[model samples]
Target: MHSIHSTDAESAQNLTRYLADEEETLKFGKKLAACLHSGLIIHLFGNLGAGKTTLTRGILHGLGYSHIVKSPTYNLVEIYKISGLYLYHFDFYRFNDYSEWEEAGFRDYFNSDSICLVEWPEKAGNLLPKADLQCFLNMFDSGRNIEIRSSTETGKQCLIHWNTEKNI
Candidate 1:
């Protein structure tokens, strides 16, 4: 894997990392969990087998969730409550129509009391709330490259916190 680096100049807006393998990705997610807070919406973009679920597992594990973490593809969404915080892991891959989002009554899920991590958000066709942070994961050779961008003040603060807390 390529060397991982964070650009301080734009640290408040974005952060990039190259994970050598699944383990690195999980570790990175764990570290990233420290920067998370309630009410942040994170949109994850990646193709199949791109380690999106693996990264989410790491983040959940870092947040002290001990149960098995799996993709919400079949279930559409999974709810986890940890330390008084509500975490909603959503997978919109099965969405055949944007109306399905509203029909499912998921609009209330994106509130100040919860943190929503959405996969295949494009499938929802802009019906979902605006993401505070957007994460892009791409496969590269035998590793993965990830870029996290902040789109709002809340996301910017998270990125800044990540910069201060990141070890790599």
Candidate 2:
């Protein structure tokens, strides 16, 4: 995995490293979910079996979704309503044609009142909107390494909350 260092001095601005175990991964996801709001878009990047689905499950659980959360590999998209937040999970792993995104009319789902999490976002090419947060997961010796970058102001705010809550 790649080693990263951040020079941002703010307590909320720093690089955090954690063991890539399942529990720790879930904890990170839950912490991230607390700071999420409507209209948020998160792009997930990782190779196969990098735990994207696990992290997403944690996010859905944190959002108060009692039902089982599954990857949208086959369905392409899954919608859930929890705690007054509209959460849309999209998996583009099977996406071969860029036109499928528009043909499916998924862009309309990114409203000001919903949160969208997309996996394999590159599969959509230039058809998708910019992500608020871009998370890259890499496989390591023991497990995985995740690097999260704030792509927008809202994402930066979420990072602030994550930093404060985790004392990172």
Candidate 3:
């Protein structure tokens, strides 16, 4: 329902947006999807029922995916290929220890040609790769309050695109 943007540095920034409903959340996610590129690591922060998966579904929709976009809660990871982009959606909610991540060998998937979207990364401690963009979501009376922080130049570029798109 509202957007507030600010820059932290030349190549780092933060933005907060209020999503009044699921439709708005999806729309925002689509915009984010357009800014995604390979080799980007994105960490999503939110509680259960906080709309993380819905936003992920929206991103997949924006990327031209028509099939089901289900959370990888059970599978641990879901792979999607679209227009030469390899997206790896990961959920570490089930992780009981940092060793679980190392044992699973999930780091191998975060390669040059892969764009990783990780949820519940806190469960993995520092074992997970650093995120280019960090997204935090909280529940709001109307819907969700979300914040996107750019930690790398690559992430800043995406936020810049997202800001510009919102203005337009």
Candidate 4:
């Protein structure tokens, strides 16, 4: 038997959009949030102050969370259980060691029927799970430039549904 390593090129397909302001970013998140499903891991790639938390807030708002949405920088992870869905918002910016992720007993959170949105995933090293979607956001002169990439079959299907709704 031959073992092969192949990348999911189909999942590599990406969608790019421009947000002219914070509202647009929130709108985009609202639209994107509806596309997400259970057991999906979304990786947020951006530097500090790049609006990761702001986008997450929009996603939470779209998911029917009426309370305040804040970054879990100090808390490491914020647990949001609403409308029969469990959303784990994790921030690993403060992580100094890879083993710290394992030590934190966070692995159990990635089970089925849960959605994980991770910021600063790189800080977790290989301890993190493979992302179904990778969302990259960059600050721009007007607002932010955002790119979304699907990296799993489930993610691709989700994007298809998002496209059907957004006419993208």
Give each model a TM-score.
0.93, 0.90, 0.92, 0.91
Candidate 1: segments with Cα more than 4 A from true spot: 1-9
TM-score of 2: 0.90
Winner by TM-score: 1
Clash count, predicted structure 1:
0
Error of 3 at 167 (Å): 4.7
Question: Model 2 — which ten-residue stretch has the worst lDDT?
Answer: 7-16
Question: Alpha-carbon error at 43 in model 2, in Å?
Answer: 0.2
Best by lDDT: 1
lDDT of all the models against the reference? Answer: 0.90, 0.82, 0.86, 0.85
Query: After best superposition, candidate 1 residue 93: deviation in angstroms?
Result: 0.6
lDDT of 2 at 8: 44
Could you give the candidate ranking by TM-score, starting with the highest?
1, 3, 4, 2
Show pairs that collide, candidate 4: none
**Clashing pairs in model 1, backbone N/Cα/C closer than 3 A:** none
* Tens digit of per-residue lDDT, candidate 1, span 10-88: 6678888889899999998899899999999999999988988898999999899999998999999999999999999
Candidate 2, residues 44-163, lDDT tens digits: the string is: 999988988888888888877878988899999988999788999999998888888889889899989999999999999989999988888888888778778887777788878776
- Model 1: how far is 46 from its true place, Å? 0.4
lDDT of 1 at 76: 94
Scored against the true structure, residue 55 in model 3 reaches a CA lDDT of 86
